[model samples]
Target: MFVRNGTSTLKKVLTCPPTFLDEAAPINEISKKYQDQPLDKAKLLDEYQQLLDAYAEAGVQVEQLTPQESMTNSVFARDFGGCVKEGYILGSFKEPLRYAEHAAYEEKMAELGIPKILEVKKGLFEGGDFAFLRENIIAVGIIERTNMEGFNELKAGLEPLGYQVYPVPADSRYLHLDMCFNLVDDNLAVAYEEGLPTEFKELLNKLEIEIIKVPEEAIFQHGCNLESLGQHRVLSLKQNKDVNNALREHGMEVIELDITETLKAGGGPHCMTFPLHRV
Candidate 1:
């Protein structure tokens, strides 16, 4: 059952792999990189398994997704998209070549019994486009990966269930809401204000949300890719020293994963874990 109350209750979750064309087999019009300098198959497999292990160790349930033969090119597959209390909202890739990405997710969600399903077909929506700040409010970015239609679709699907969808206009530096945003807890978050619209900042202030600024270097390094493991706990793929310190000062545990090879293709811990339940 979905937890009605606390972040501490989010102990169970799900994650996908770095099934990008380079990490897995080349599918669709996936880059030539997979066919060119391939990542060591064994190492890639190990990395996926290690991610599984990390979740398992944290007491997070794991449901591994197998890649579709046609959507390997889509980066959405790499991060697994933003998930809500009901279940994972799988992305329908906006990129034409990545359009086939959604077809296979239904079967996986069925296997896991995730009740709700949201698909943005006409509008481009990647997983990185949304951020959950609190149970009622979420921040979504209008970027190349996430569009106005997709954002609207997400709100239509979620708001009826009592979730409030907030929009944050983004620039190129952060292609997705997640690139410069994430909720550490009910009251805390990190953001790159340069990309966050004034309207969104005003909304955050109205809600009494605390904004922790990520340094220019950290934002550039994708520091906003932080994922919450539990209350005051976090997991980051790259070890940005500044981000780590900021998190620590805020009383959050920052665990860094070795993702140099995995992230090169695009994505981090938040993209990997599609949390289905909060225990």
Candidate 2:
């Protein structure tokens, strides 16, 4: 079945190679600083391959979406759309440059026979802002990328399906909810508390999900963007030493990969993958 929560065991996933990760045209503040120097395509490919290897080692079935030359941020597959227990929820892009990605994801979903449950037609809703906290609960980030209109639309559709949609307000600078908050275990999350609203933190506490606070210095490094592989396992960035160490201390099996090249484009392991099937 499609994933119901982020902390479930990832059995199958979709990804796109960094075929057009050009640093010249910046997408965020992180990429803007790297515009002076061109990205080393060779090194980037190597790093991406290593991520694929890590997934294979974990026994995850990988599917790839072909990237168009002009879609520089297409490598971040998680922004395309998201899956629910019943079907796929088509995403609407806020950035004009990412508008074409929705159509590509639609075609892929159709090809894979994944039924479409709802398509965001009002305002904007990127998949990066959609986070499933539990089987019947989801947190949608009401940030610059995903506005109240979009959140309302999603809530209207999902609430009928027994989902309790929570609106988490975050600064536009964080880009997406996954950037500042993500699940590392069924009962544990790694979050950059300063970047999120106090209510969001309170909500997590109310849910009994312990927090592994990520410092401001580690926020930009995508320290909180690690992926959960279920069974108390996580796929993280080798550079996020503190976060990885904390996971290990909590009895998690952390698989670290060096995706520094991909991080230059303002995404990490979690951002680079779209879950197709989870258990």
Candidate 3:
């Protein structure tokens, strides 16, 4: 089965081991800070294993894609594609460095026997920009990595499948919508209000979803990018103290993990995962 919504119980996911993640290039605003420092591959692998262990403990099945040495950013598996009720929507990339990663995801999907719902032929649309807010409602980002053309293409394909897709415009610096907005529960979301436009905020308000606003400082740390494990539980970065505390205060279980090595590459727990099956 495919994921019904973002906050639904995540039953299965896809990830790529950081076997070839070696450097932090100037890909985005966040990764630019670590351009001078060298990434520790050993530590990255260990941290990735910890994430895999967490998924196993949470009763979520995991499938791994064969890592390629040339595709360093493939560790951010969420950008490859997105899974829907019908099948998978293969993504297109804006950065030339990531263009080849598309074929890898297609091969993995075919190997897993997951059919393709849409291939996103027109414009750039990464999985990080797409999120299923509910069973039929989806919020996609119009940011540096994704454009209006991509949003329209996705809407045209999914609307026929009973999905309503909304475009959320955000600052290009934010990279993707998940960087500032992510659903943690059926009626709860974490967001960096300053980075989002008024229309998106109004949409959330119309849906009656409570927003846990993160501070501006936390935005660079990818604090809003968290994975919901269903049942009011979430996997977050250990350094996001304020967000974790806020989640705990809201009666949610927060499982913190040390992923400093991986963070140097401008991704968080949510970015490292691609949801496959959820209910």
Candidate 4:
């Protein structure tokens, strides 16, 4: 749960880093495999800072990322929960090879001034795949990165915090809920028309939220990724053409920034910025 704002609101968001547990745990290996990234690694860090700058420029209060051991995948860094009063739930990284990703969140949360970090021993939960749909209900994607154990942990922990958790089956290709849908605003979200199941759409419809259609291929491009900062404010990657159009068409003011490097690592602006609070 990264803050939509800047350092002014650090404690409000939750975040984590990558570590060695799974095959993707060693980042150095990744560097050896890919010689020329479509987006440069050095530039990715700069672009990530730029994305963070945008949030700061927009009155967003950011909490820095949680520190974990070096892992090959940033996806490991993202396997954390939104936020809870008692603490943030660190979901087990479904990639057994990367399962240790959850371990990093504890230190990150402590640095953010939130000392309590909760973990689910019984299930696997991924924050990337969970969405706070309404007052007490959250929609989670049941996939490889997230499992029944994660689902149960999210449900049991968040429900008592006044968040009702629901599971949505996902297409194996994308492997993440954010790859399919994201809460762009309080009343609207960008959803991949084909990436997610029909039942999930039906359930979302039941909540009265308007789902803006984002193409399946676009989602693979990470177009559906977004973060809501209240007051119709949004954080997203500038490269996602279709998603930007969908957000603007809905009358929401968009803050498009560059995060090509970060996204290529399997996440985008939403993945980089851990919003501390919405308001």
- The true-versus-predicted C-alpha distance at residue 31 of model 4, in Å, is 12
- When summed lDDT is taken over every stretch of 10 residues in candidate 4, the lowest stretch is 20-29
Residue-wise lDDT of candidate 3 within 173-226, one digit each (tens)? 888888989999888889988788888888888999998998766768989999
TM-score of each: 0.84, 0.97, 0.98, 0.81
Measured with C-alpha atoms, the lDDT of residue 80 in candidate 1 is: 39
Off by over 4 Å in 1: 3-8, 23-40, 73-82, 87-90
**What is candidate 1's lDDT per residue for 16-121, written digit by digit as tens?**
5545545533321222234456665456556677777777777777766666556654333433355666666666565555556566666677787776556665
Question: What is the number of residue pairs that collide in model 4?
Answer: 29
lDDT of 2 by residue, 1-279 (tens): 688788888898888898887674576757777877878899888988998999999999999889897677888889877799799899788877787788888898888888999988976888888887778889988866888998888999988989999999987778888888898788899988887788778888888998899886576799988889998999999988999889999999999998887788788899898999898
Q: Supply the global lDDT for candidate 2.
A: 0.85
Each prediction's whole-model lDDT (CA):
0.65, 0.85, 0.89, 0.61
Lowest lDDT sum, 10 consecutive residues, model 2, at: 22-31
Order of models, best TM-score first: 3, 2, 1, 4
Q: Go through the candidates in order and give the clash count of each.
A: 3, 0, 0, 29
Which candidate model has the greater lDDT, 2 or 4? 2
lDDT of 4 at 142: 84
Which prediction has more favorable TM-score, 1 or 4?
Answer: 1
lDDT of 4: 0.61
